[model samples]
Structure formats: C-alpha cells, structure tokens
Target: MREPADVAVVGTGVVGLAVAVELLHRGLDVTVVGPRTGAHQGQGTRAAGAMLSTFSELEPQHDAVRAGMETAERLAAHQAYPAWLERIEAMGGGTVQAPSGTWVLAPAGRRSCLDPIAAAARAAGHSVEEHDASSIPALRAPASSAGALWLPTESRVDSAALMEALSRAVEQQPRATWISQSATAVSAGTVACTEGETVRAREVVLAAGCGIPALLPECGRPLGVPPILAGRGVSARLAAPGVEVEQVVRTPNAEFACGAHLVPRTDGTLYLGGTNRLTLDADPAQAPSLDEVAVLASDAAALLDPRLGAASLLDTRTGLRPYTLDHLPLIGRTGDPSVLVATATYRCGVLLAPRLAQLVADEITAPGSLDAHPYRALRPMPAPRIDDVLADGAAQGLLEHLLQGGGHLPPAQQDEFAAFTALALRALLDEGSQAGAAVRRLWERAPVIEAVPALFALARRLEGVR
Candidate 1:
C-alpha cells in the first residue's frame, strides 16, 4: 500500500482529469487512479460531444441552467477551450474549433418546448431569437420547419484533442502522477486500487462517473443524498466535406426525437450525437446501435448542408453519464470530511467540468469560503427518490388548477378542488418530496389552473364565492 498523497482522484475521465489538474495547480500532490490503459484509457473523454452551451440545454428556470451558463462563461474566459486549444496546438493534435456561438433549431411542432424556456431565458436577460429554419443555411439544407436560437457566446471543443492536451498538461506538472490502476474501494482516508496499491490522501474525491457508487458505496447516500444513476449516451462521428456550421444545432422535441447535434472541426470530421439511455449496465464497449446511427445520420442530413450527405461514417462510440434524480450536479464535500464525492453532472459533464473542478478545488483548499449548506452531504431535506416522482405528478396537477381557474369551479367542486390544492401545496412545500424544486420551477414558467385548496383560499380571500 502506497502512502496517500494530498488528493487521490479515482477515474481519469474529463471530470477526474480536470480535478487532478486543479488540485495540482493548487500545490497539492495528486494521484489519478483509473484504467487509463488498454481499451479504457480516455474512453469517456473520447466519446463526449463536447458542447459548451451551458444555458441552452435545459429550461432556463433551472438553477443549474443559470449556474451552468455562468460557469461556462467563467471557464471559457478563464480555463477551458482556450487553454486546451493552446495545449493541443503545442502537442500538434491536428486542428480544433473554438466557435463562440451555438445554434439550436426549434421545429414548429415542438415550439412549445421553447415558449416557457424562452420566457425563462428572458427572465435571465439573455437575448434569444426564434429564427425560422430557413434562416440557417445548414438547417435550411435539411428542409425542416423549425426556427433557430442563436447563443452567440457559447462554444464547442474538440473533446479528443482536449483530452490529449489534458494528459499533456498533467504530465507537465511535476507532482502529478497518472497511475494506471482501477480503484476498488475507499476506506477511511485511503483509496485501494483493484491491483492492491493503496494511496493515502488528505482528501479523496470519487469522480469516476457511472462507476462511482460501485467504487464507493458510501457515496451513494453520502449524508442521505440520493444515489447516482447511470445515463448511457451513444454517439457516432462522420467524415464530412467540411460542412461549415457556425454553431452546434439541436432540435427540441418531447424526446430528442429528430434531435441531432452537428459539431464541426477543422479536420473535416464532425461528431454527431447522441442517444441518452438510462441504464444500470455500465459497459463502455457497447457499440452505438445501428438504428441510432441511422436515425442520427438521417437527422443530421436533414439539419445540415449538402456536404454532410456525402460524408462517410467514421466511427461510433458510447459512454456512461452519471445522472441524479434531480438534474442538478452533485458537487462539494460530503458530511464526512475526508471523502468528497463529485459525480453526476449528467450530459452536461463537459460544460460543467471547469467550474465544478474549481468549486471542488476551492472547497478542499480554502474550506472557509464555500458554504456546503446547499450542497451538504446530508441534505437538509430528504431527497426525492425515483419512486416519489409518480406522486409528485399528481400533486403537480392539483397545484396547477388552483393557481389558474380554481375559482371558476362550481361550489361543490370548489371544496374538493380546495382539498386537492391544499394537499398538493403541502407536498410541494415538503422538502422530502421526490420532485424537489422541479415542480416550483415549472410552475414559475407556466401558470396552472386553480382546482381545490387554491380555489377555497381564493374564494375566502376574495369577497364572494359561487
């Protein structure tokens, strides 16, 4: 068993690698343990679609959407693609794209997806345009009815090149060691790898993506938080005739349906993705489904220019995404001081990496400034588990009615509506509700009809009832 270093980061994927670099930069001795050999070396990083549109992915009212946007801005300005690009250029890792904008297509049928989101974005004071599909040459090339939302400041990075650069960056640091080993468990203040090498550390961070809970069971409920689930994302890259797309393109639908993203690089190869499937099976070798590739390719052809039609399929890949029940990421230290669990950024891992790394690093290095209250290992309220989602749905429906036309219901129905509304509000206000903040966030975006208790409350507050 090797003595512990200052920090032992399990899993050398983008998240782990980023944390390793950050810790080393802060003058800490760090050991990155992972199967960074054979077929697994850099698999997660290689499979990423690497879009840096922090605020564009979700409903704008989401705390993470706002936080992600701010985080992306800070990382782009201080520590992401630019720094990565410089390092890649030095390493001669071919070419990379540093585009400053992201383009999203909103098909007419799916326009409802953006109404509330656009309203939310407006609340955040961001300029959002609903451009008809014809507005974009590549999008128009596909003959779709959707318009586009252009976020001019967002960017994309060549993930593979970026990962290689990170490897180089870590090598440059004298105190950093990228050890080839799989971490099996975390005990007390030490991490024991599968190969029996133990590294002691003042701080141990489990950034192993979907493999997290399996590596360290304590992390699953660290201080009573919910367990992390694995969200599988499959993607394929195509060799194209250098389609000139100024920004990343995504179609918003109930599901990603015809949703496809086209990320172009100077190398004439574009990375298209991705099918997000939730599963407990964590196999990296699972090839992209032929059906998925065909669909993705078809969607890309519809959304991209003629050049993409002539492109050949180069390769397909898959990786596991750590998803929490609530979409927000799990960052900061656990109630257990020595073990810090930083996983579950979902699909936004790349977008959230730099900020998350810095946040974790800051907490570990300068503990006084960060208030772990919000991200406390022991959540002040019980987290909403997967089973609770069903109940939350019913409560959501009741609350909507009361907020809207509950007063319009007949007197007999009004009392029932009032009862339903009260129950709903009580559950919503309860921190233990599985829906967590999603119910409130959604309500803020779209008003609901008043049904039960809300109707009663309104009738009582107002002069007269029916």
Candidate 2:
C-alpha cells in the first residue's frame, strides 16, 4: 500500500462518484478506483433514462395507506430530490437537466391503475392532473388504456452527459483522484486493486452495486453486509428523425419486464427501454438480442409515435441495478467500523445520488450527524425464497427454461422453444431471451437463485415423463 489518503471510494458509478466529489469538497483527501471505459469514463452509470422521478418511483397510496404512513418517509425523500439534483448540477456546472416533466400513462382500460399513484402524489402536495391518453400525442394511448396522470414536476437527467461531467469535475478537484482499476478486495481502510496496487485510506466507501455483498466476505467482514441481488436491464437507443421527442413517456403496467418507457436526449436521440431479469454477472460481455430491441421499440412506437419504429438503431446498453431484500437503499457504516456502504439505490441511484452522497459525507465527517436512513446494513430482513421469485412475471420464462424437456410441455410450447433455439432465442421476449445465458452462468456468477426443490417441482410439472 502506498500514500493512503483520508478516504477511498471503491466504485465510480454515479453514487460512488458523487460520494467522492462530496468528500473531496468537504476538504478530505480522496482516491477513487474503478474500471474505466476510457481514461475518464465509468460503467453502470450508463444505460438509463436518468429520470429524477421521485413520485413516479413510489408504490401506490393503497399500499402506503395500508402500511399506515409507511409512505410518509418516502414523501420526505421526494421533497429533497430536486435540491439534490440542483446540487449535482452545480458541481457539474449545469451539465444535467430536468428539462421537462415526466408523463405516466395507464393502458386505456386500466385507468384505475393511476389511482394509487395519483393519491400518493397528491399526498405529497405535488400537482397531478388526470387525462385521456389522447391528451399527450406522444403517449399514443391505445383504446385499451385507461388514461394517464401527468406530474409536471417530475424530470429527466442527461445521464450520459452527467456521468462524464461528474468524472471530469471529480478529477479536477484538488483533493480528489480517480484511479482506473478494478478493486480486488476492500476492508475498513485498505483496497487491493487488480492492477496490483494497494490503497490505504482513513475510511472507505463500498458502492460497487451487486459487488458489495460479494466483496464483503473477501474483505473478512462478510457478516456486516446484507444480501444484495442484481437486476440486469437492457436498453436500446434510437435516432429520432425530424423533431425529436421533447417529453418522457411510459406505460402504466410493464407486466413481465421492467416498465416500457421512452426518454429523449438533448441531441434528439430517443431511448426505448428497458427489460429487467435476474442476473449475477454485472459485467457480462453479452449484448441485447435484436428481438428484444424490437419489442421495446414496437411498444414505444405504438404508445408514443409511429416514427419510433422507423427510427435508426443507434446503440444498445446494459446496466445491472443493485437491489436489497427490502428494495430500499442501504447507506451508511456497517459493523466493520470503517467500511461505509452506499450502493443498492437500484433504479433511483442517479436521481438520488446528490442527497445520498450528502448523507454519507455527513456521516463520515461527523458520525451520527444525519439521522439513519430507513435502509441499514445490519437490518434483520430475511432473504426471499427462490421459488416465490420464480413465479414472478416476465421471468416466468426463466423457470420454464430451467425445467426443459418435461415432455409435458405442450407440443406447441416445445415447438416455440425450438424456434427460438434455432435462431438463438431471438423470438423469446422479456427475460426469456436472457434466461438461458443467465442460467448457464447461475452457480458460476448469479448473485440470487431460487431453491432446488422448487426447481424440481417446476420441472416435473413441465415434463410428461421424468
């Protein structure tokens, strides 16, 4: 180990970068180590709508109401969202923008779907207006759709630009340094890098997404971190012709995959995304299937505009969001004393970074300065059973795939599987396409998987003969 600084942040995604910048600005010596796309680029932070939609991400009021002010806490979090975005923009010199409000739609027949959301938003005192899908030409609400609600205050961030801007801004800080390397192991104040460098720091922040739980054991204090899983998502970017979309649009229900949403970049490119499936390998070299891209594109085109389907395919990107057992972010120190946990913000990482960083930095400089966040590393939430997870939609295909050759699978189902296999799973939609690859790598890499007995039962149900 050489030149141990005051702080070492072992990740460069939005959360890690934000924490590093915050600490540096707080007058602490800081060193950041993570894989780099180039001399100054980051992974994981890419591939997102970068929407700072606080209310949009919340569960409906029905659940909140039933939980008895359980959501009051989330509303408090929402109140601080805008301020955090402003803080980040100030650091990046206005590189990120929440240019316009976000519009959410419920398929025509499902208008009722917007109720709980609207209720929650109204409870938060945010103005909400309900209207038919036709209200927004961009959403192209089908007759089947129930309608939608618009939250003009909800906004999107230029995720790619913000990421680049953060990297540059962080590197320019006199007290901060960005080291391009993969961390092999991390403890309270020491981080060992794959590049054969050992960094010693006064304290360390482990914000490496799914890698958090995996690395804790390697650091000799695995018991301090909770079980965290990874949700892999695929998104495709399209080049919009003529006037580019000026607003964000999304479906009310996403059924088996992540929700269907569209985000327009400042440069006029539109992003149609994304699909979520359980994956262990956060850095898989695999690419999204053309069929997967088409499904998202076609859905967006149907909702937003016909031009979307005809748009040029610019590129596709993938990101693995870290998920906790309770779906809340785990921030703050662990029993390991010096190890501060800041990953697991999941889909809200970019939008919530500024505030989260502030909380982490406050804790670091003055322990217990900020009250504890709802998510704690040592919480007693039990991990979910793998079988209960299997039946979850969009991922049902994964379970089906795991039980192959139960000759009980109808001839039609087998024929369908054969078709996709012949063309390399091209026809499988949602998680089906990614299921095979994920299963093959399960024990080798997947962070979460269901139990074996459930697998056998599913297989038995699928097979005519064992």
Candidate 3:
C-alpha cells in the first residue's frame, strides 16, 4: 500500500514522464509507476529519432478536418519544444542536444511526394527552400537523385539523452514518487502492480503506449480507449567515421513508414531509421532482423550517402509505435471521468510530448476545457470509405515497393507494376469480403504482413457492428 497522491501516471515513457512532470509543476502530488529498465525495449521513446518535425510529417489526407487539426497540434508542439526543453533542463534533466534544421530528400521520380509536404509547410507559415541534390554538402546523391528541400525548422534530439533527462527531472521532484515495477491493472483511482502493490490516487492517467490495451479490462468497463496497434520500427546506429551530416537528413513520409532518415547524435554516431511493421501486440524482447537492417543500410546509402552502406553497424534498436485506426493520437479524458488515456501518438510521440502534457494537465486542473478537442480518447472515428482505402492502399503500396528497389525497373515497367498492385489489392478486398476490406484499410495505414492479427480483430469488430 502507498499513500494516495493527486495522480497516478502509469508508464515511464516520454509521454508518461512529461505528464507527471507537468502535473507536479501544477502543485500536484504524483506517484509514477513503471519498470525502469528492459521494460522499455521496443517502445517508441527508446528507439525514436525524436525528430521535432511539424512539416516533414505532413502528407495528403482525405479527411480535411482531421488533417487540419493534426497539423495545428503538431505545429503547436513544435513551437513549444524549445521552451519546454529549457524547463526540463532547469529541473536537472540535463541538456538535450538537438541539432537544428533537416534536409528532406526526394529521390528520382518522387518529386510529386515532396510537393504536398512543401505546400503544407508554406500554408502553415513555415519557410521551405528547394535545392539541387548534389548541392547539399556531405551527401553522395545517387545517380537517380531528384532534388532536396531545406526545412530549417525541423530538428531531431538524441532520444536516449532526452529520456535520461526526463527521468532525472522526475526523480528530483520531491512531490513525485517513482515505483520501479510494471503496472498490471489500473482503475479509476488505483493501479495494481506486478508485485501485488496498489497505489491509489484521486486521478489516473494511462500513458502506457501499447500496454494500454492489456490494462483496459481491469478498469471494470470500457474507457473508450480506441483500438491501438503497434507500428514496429527498426533503426540502426552507425559509426561511419567519414560519413557525417550537420543536420537531419530524411525522405518525405513514404508508404506506411516515416521513410529513411539520418540523425546526427552528439557522440559522432549517426542514427539511421525507416522501417514500419504494424502488429496487434508488441514483443519487448523482439530483436531487429538482418533483412530489416539491410534495408535500412541500403536505403540510407541510396537516399543520403553511399558511405552509410559501409558504415560500421554499431547497434540496432526496435521501437513499437502505438497508433489508432485513423492514425491520430487519443488524448484527454476517456469514458471514466477520473481516468485519461494519452497513447496512440504513432510516429510523433517525442515531438508532441510537451504539448500533450500541457493538454493533460489542463484537463486535470479544469475539466471540460478540452471538451471540443478533436482527439478526445473516446471520440467516434469511423473508418474511411472502402473505395478511399483501396485507392490510398494501392498508391502507398506501390510507393513502398518502389522504395524497396522496385524503382530500378524501367519507367514503363514501373507503371505496369503499379497497375498490377492496385488490381491485386482489389482482388484481395473482393475475395475476403469484409475481412479483406478491414485488412486492406489497416494495410494502407501500416502496410506490414505482421499486421494480420490486428487486421482480423478489426474485421470481426466491423462485422459485429454491421
């Protein structure tokens, strides 16, 4: 048994720590519960490039309203990050080293992909500049390179350093108590731990990322927490002595992944990231596959510099990014008034942490302040139309295939391949009926073969509704 506090925040990831720190700043007593070690393997914060990207993440969205709101939220968070980092540092979290600016590269024949990103950035009042691929220093542009865009506003932080700082900040706060154990169950005001310890508080926040689904049943009823799937990504750290870039170098979001990106860490090592495989459940013990690492290396070589392929592979990390069906975060109060859910941030957890923390604190201090907030945890998010799903699926699938060496084919063959992919997807949808439709929808959002279990669950749910 532990003394009741003002709040009990489950999970110690970026979001959980951010929320706890924010609440503590508001004069609240907090009990932070979560394991401090290997528990975070495959979790987003541990393996994230932590790009504070507002514009680079923008893509063409069929739902204008959703797109607009998402952009607004990301922009708000991007603006607040610097100040927020300053505050954390002041609390003894240590300084977070984040290099300024990012180069968004467009490979040959993919100029169309960069157009929408640049347009969205301009509409949001950010400056974007186009430059010849070869003009960028330290880049060994492939012969098929198209061009590049300079986004001065985008940047990336060393995720491991940031996480250490957050932990230090929370540990320094006298009003916060850190429990080094996994939370087995959570309810309105009580959280049961793995060791049979129960901590009670007036309010509870579930920020456990992919762990949310498991604890939801213990809440005694539905919390309106949306279905969360894991977007598993594999990233590698390379010690390429002669290969270096001053800033973040990445491609525009491609297929269901964030695309290949390189982030320079303070220690002279480079972070190479760009693979997304969605799954129904995340395995913390899962290791990165050789094939995945090979793709990352080849993509880095093709898109950024050839030296990356020869770079010494220092280590590889896996992160399971939690996402919803519609690919938006589920924040704010859930069906349980006393419990708020703030997971499913997908690819932008680190970028959006500070803003989301503020949002969570505001809701706690003043309920109904975010009643009209678009990402309310239990809000209705119907699936996109079947036709829209098929269209986007084919387009993204083709892009993914191309990025994975399919682009080597002749232009005419590439077009034929695109048509063939679209036809195959249509056939899959038609033959599998409702189940096929559900899988196709999930595939477009996260085109990974490992997503079949989640796809089936979605199919059954939709079937029940019908």
Candidate 4:
C-alpha cells in the first residue's frame, strides 16, 4: 500500500478544490487529484456562470428530490461568498465581480408563470420587486417584453476570476499536494492513475463532476450507480451595442432559448446562453454544436434588443453538466463509507461550492455536524417513467400514482396490467436505468401498436423472471 494521506480528494473542479482548501485550513494533509492541475482536463468550474442566487432558482418544480432547498443549508453555500471572496482576495487572488440584481422576465401579459416563483421567494423571506414595462430597458425587438420581477438579492459572479482565485488558494496550501493525472480507477482509498501509479489515502472525496459514475465501478462497491446524465450547455460572449442594463437580465422558460437566460458581464460582454442537450455518449473534445449556437443567438436577438443582432461576438464555450434522474445533487458519503461523493449539482455547482465544501469537509473531519438525509449518496435512484422520463424528484409520486390507480387502463385487467407493467419496466432497467432520450429513440424506431404487444410478449416469456 502506498503511503496514506490525511485525505485524498479526486477531481479538481471548484467543489474538489474548495474541499482541499477547507481541509488544509483545518490542518489536515490533503492531495487534490484531477486533470486541470495535472491529470488531463476536467472541465467544470471554468465554464460556470458562478451565479450566487438560490432565491432566483427557487422553482418548486424540483421540490420532490431537493425539498427544503430554500432552507438554511442551501443558502449557506451562496452566503459564504462574501466572506470567502474576501479570504481569496486576501491571498493575492483576483476578485470575482458580483453585479447587483437580476431581472426575471416573462412575455407580454404572461406573468402567470412567475406567480409561483414570486410566492416562493416571499415565503422564503426574499424580496421581489415588480417593474412597469414602460420604464424597463429598451431591448430592441422581439426579446423586449413588458417588464420584469427584480430579484435584487440574486446576483452573479465572474466565474473565471473565482476559479483562478480557487486554484491559487489550493496551490498556496502547504499541506495540499496537487496531482496531475487522470484517475483511471479508484478502490477503497487507492486511486489508480492512468500514468501507472496508485495513490492511496485513509478517506477519499469524489467530486469528479459528470465523471462520477465512471469512477464508481472502480471503487469496489457493487451497489449500482446513479446513471448520471450529462447535459451540454453552450454559451456565447458578446458585446451588447446599445443595451443599457446594469443587472443580469434573464427570462423564465424560453422554449426558443435554452433556459432563456442572458447575463451582462462586468467587462461589457453580454453572456448569452445556454443550449442544453443530452450528451450521454458524446465526446467533450468536439467543438460546441453550431446548431445550438445559432438557436441561442437567434433566441437572444428575439428576446432582447434587435441591436443584439449587431453585437460583437467574443467567444463561445461549452461544458457538460452532470444531472441525476432525480435532479437532486448527491453530497454525502457513498455506500462505502471510505469514499464520499459530491456531484450532480448541475448548473448550481459553482454557486454551491463554498458551502458544500464546508459541509463535506465537516462530514469528513467532524462527522454529524450536518444532516445527511437531504444529500444521502446511496439512496435508490428512481427511473423516469416512459411518459415522464427523468423523475424530476417525483420518483415516489410516480410509484404512488401507479399503485393508487393513476393511469390504469381497464378495471377488469388492472391487476395484470399493473403486474405486467411492473415486470416489463424492471426488465428494461436491467442493464441500468436511462434518461428520457433513449425511450424517445425506442418509440421512434418501432410503431407503438406493434412495439407494445411485442415487448409485452417478450416480458411475459422471459425465463426465471418473476
């Protein structure tokens, strides 16, 4: 066995690096292993928007997986920015400029979608201000709508500066060793490097972003992994020609645009994003999809001032965000206590890093300080139904619906239908559960009338399957 360190953290994204800094702050010997430092290129924090607004993201749509998100724990991460940013700057690291305010907009006279969002913010003690359309910024054409709800507390930080600062902090630590090598495998406390070296420690922290499931099999735990789905988000940086907005301006659920989001950087570049597609098996080395870029640009032009059409383009970037079937982030220890996990925060990874690092660090060094129920690592992951793929945290709800007669066909054959449904669905999940895209693909390949009876017969004839 190689020499064991106090702690070995895998992955060098913001979360992993933050954990290293926290552990070192507490006087624990630490080693951070991942590509950016030496391994290869673990892309995550670098491509993040680093928005620190849980209040802005308080859509009750995901209440099933991540309940109590508005509670103190989630806010702790976003709240740590003020103090943490100061600490980073004190170490000679550059600053992350967090502009004040964010505008959540809706189409003309269609503010109904925002009612629940506004109500949730008030219930969580956050402030929301409504603005009249006449006084709002003159966004050129289609994108310009009546007015918006001003989320004064929801702010965004420059992610590039934050990551540079974090990298500096991690490097400055005397007890933290920076290892640059792709971790090919991990078992117990030992991580097998692609460079033919095995590094071991007493405990390990896996913060490998979307690469979590890949390393889980190597960890010697056979309790199955949450088949993580990767959503590729693309962003374009541009200079708004005539736009006169000081705060981050965003739209709620723009179908034409991915997330229908736009942000004006401190450096005068309007950051327009983001196109999300399921990149389950796609290679990240490929360039950002041009189709996605075109749609985003088109959407921005329509949603904002027509002058956006004349804006200067700076650069385009892409990052694969790790998403789970339930949409809830995994943050606690895994089935094997030796290997703790923190991945699947999705778009909120950058915002949640600081507080999540503190919580995970405390869990390792000082256990029981934070409740693990909300972030339990090894709970049974629910499969997305064919109709509602990617449970969106209503796994239990879907199960209860099936059991409570939500969509049973005929009463005469209800029991057989339910049993057959249960058996066939279980078989489809044999290899591993998948996200919605696969089911959609299957439907496209075969006619529903023919495919239905075919799959049913196949399920019924399977040997030794109860």
lDDT of each: 0.61, 0.65, 0.80, 0.64
CA deviation > 4 Å runs, candidate 3: 61-64, 218-221, 393-396, 410-416, 429-466
On lDDT, the candidate that comes out on top is: 3
Worst 10 residues of 4 by lDDT: 397-406
Cα lDDT of model 3 by residue, 1-466, tens digit: 5679999999899999999989988889999999876647877898999888887876654356766788889999988988889988988888986777988888777777677778778998889999888877677777777888898888788888889999999989999998899999888899999988899999999999988888878432377676777888999988998767878888877666787898888889988898887665479779998877887877888777877778998989998898887787888888889888888898999999999999999999999877888777877876455456546554445445445732466767766766665565556667657667665666665543334334434645876888
Which residue pairs in candidate 3 have backbone atoms (N, alpha carbon, C) closer than 3 angstroms, thus clashing? Answer: none
Instruction: Indicate the residue-level lDDT of 81 in model 4.
Output: 75
Query: Least accurate stretch of 10 residues (summed lDDT) in model 2?
Result: 421-430
Supply the TM-score for candidate 3.
0.90
Candidate 3: count of backbone clashes, pairs at least 3 residues apart or interchain = 0
> What alpha-carbon RMSD in Å does predicted model 4 have with respect to the real structure?
8.9
Count of backbone clashes, every candidate in sequence: 21, 16, 0, 11
Best by TM-score: 3
Alpha-carbon RMSD of each model:
10.7, 7.5, 4.6, 8.9
Q: Write the per-residue lDDT of candidate 1 for residues 1-466, one digit (tens) a residue.
A: 4566888888877888878877877788988888654656225566777887544666423355555554444344334656645643554443455666677776433455556545545665666677766676444444544456766656787787667666677777778777788888875578887777778888888888777777666645654445666656677777765465656776542231114677776576778874554454567667777765765665566544545667788887877777565545777666567777677777667766766777788888887434643443444543453224323343433433233211134556755764665565546645453353544543332222212223223324433522
What's the CA RMSD of model 3 in angstroms?
Answer: 4.6
Give lDDT for model 2: 0.65
Q: Report how far off residue 104 is in candidate 4 (Å).
A: 0.8
In terms of lDDT, which candidate is stronger, 1 or 3? 3
Model 1: number of backbone collisions: 21
| Candidate 1 global lDDT | 0.61
**Tens digits of per-residue lDDT for model 4, 188-230:** 8888888887788888888887777677674324734565666
TM-score for each predicted model, relative to the true structure: 0.73, 0.79, 0.90, 0.78
